[model samples]
Target: MTEEIIIAGFGGQGVLSMGKILAYSGIMQDQEVSWMPSYGPEMRGGTANVTVIISDNRISSPVLKKFDTAIILNQQSMDKFESDVKPGGTLLYDPNGITSHPERKDINIFKIPGAALAAEMGNPKTFNMIVLGAFLKVKPIVAIENVKKGLEKSLPERHHKLIPLNIEAIQKGMVNVESVNSI
Candidate 1:
């Protein structure tokens, strides 16, 4: 089955990074993938979002109408895309950013405190990784082993030591799986 996901947040919140990880992981898993980020005037502070499509077969369209899943890091994103998600689709929102609750009952919304959890992990920047972990548990597009390998390959050679910490952050997010489907 194919999966389409949108990762949305304000600038500097690593919205693109999460998309990159998803694309990289999909590549590692030998899946057809495409990552499309908003390119027009969103370069400013309006909204930054990326769409990642992973499929076992050839991808038909790069544009997505109903995302199978979403990771919203900011309130604007939550307000903007939560309603557009497909019924039964998953929504992972950063509680630190999103304030409003979704009124839709058809979609599964997981409000993950990724920013706070990353801060507790001693690296506030790892919020993207935390979100990745949650996606791993929910969508599971790629195996954890491939994800680790892709992550190691993506990082600079000099900063390879940070891989373990990223893995830890991922594991911590995974441990909170029960909260994922519920949130």
Candidate 2:
């Protein structure tokens, strides 16, 4: 099976980091994966996007015109990626950032209060992890245990203690999204 996901937002919002975590977790799971990030000048405050491809078999291309899932952290990201998501693709958007609700009948959309949830978890910086947890809940391609390991491995040594909190944040996000989807 193959899954292509796009994560987009402002540079400091941790969009690339989220995509990298997913790619690294996919690799840990013995899956073929690629994380391609756009290197543009506006990365500081402007848009930043990362494309992650995970597959059980060999990957064909790193570039994508369509994706199975799009995780948008800002309205600009939503506007930019909305047209590119494939029919029946999943969209995980930050409800606070994206003002316009999509009108597409083919694609599925989930509006999450990811940043707020992270702040509620005691670290606003963990917004990316919150959204990452939601992504895991929706996709389930990578095991959460592996993702927790990835979080520990990928983060700096000084931040090791934050892993458990991040894990809890992820669990909270998963529960939040699951409850929303159920209703």
Candidate 3:
């Protein structure tokens, strides 16, 4: 099986890191994966995006014109990637940053209040993990055990203490995501 995903958000929202962790998790699962990131010069406040592909077999290319899933964190990304999702694909978004809702009849749409939830948890940095958790719950493309291992691999040793908190945020996301619509 192969899943092509695009995650887009404002910089400093952990967009790249989220994709990295997902890629690492795929690796831990013995799956072939590729992660590609794009960002503006402003970084922290500018837009950033990452494309990740996980496959059971060898990956042919990292670039993709369409995605199986699109995780959009802001209005701009929602506008840009909404049409990029393939028919019957999944579209996950954070409602806090969205001005308009997605309109699609062929794909599934879900909403995860990542930013708001992270703030409620008293750690804004966990927003991405929350979104990741929601994605995993909806797709189950990678195991949670592998995700924990991926977090260990992705985070520096000094930050290991925060792993549990991050995991908790992910769990919250899994439970909190709202199913907006389904095909």
Best by TM-score: 3
Clash count list over all predictions:
1, 0, 0
For residue 129, what is the lDDT in candidate 1? Answer: 85
TM-score per candidate, chains pooled: 0.92, 0.91, 0.95
Q: Give the TM-score of candidate 3.
A: 0.95
- Pairs with steric clashes in candidate 3: none
Poorly placed runs, candidate 1 (over 4 Å): 177-183
Candidates' lDDT values, in order? 0.80, 0.82, 0.93
Candidate 1 lowest-lDDT run of ten: 174-183
TM-score of 2: 0.91
Decreasing lDDT order of the candidates: 3, 2, 1
Please identify which of the two predictions, 1 or 3, would achieve the higher TM-score against the true structure: 3
The residue-by-residue lDDT of candidate 2 on 1-183, one tens digit each, is 899998998878888888887887887788999998975554565789999999999999888889999988888877878888898788888787567866676777776789888878778888988888888888898999788777777889999988888788778778777322321
| Predicted structure 1: lDDT | 0.80
Best by lDDT: 3
What lDDT score goes with residue 78 in model 3?
90
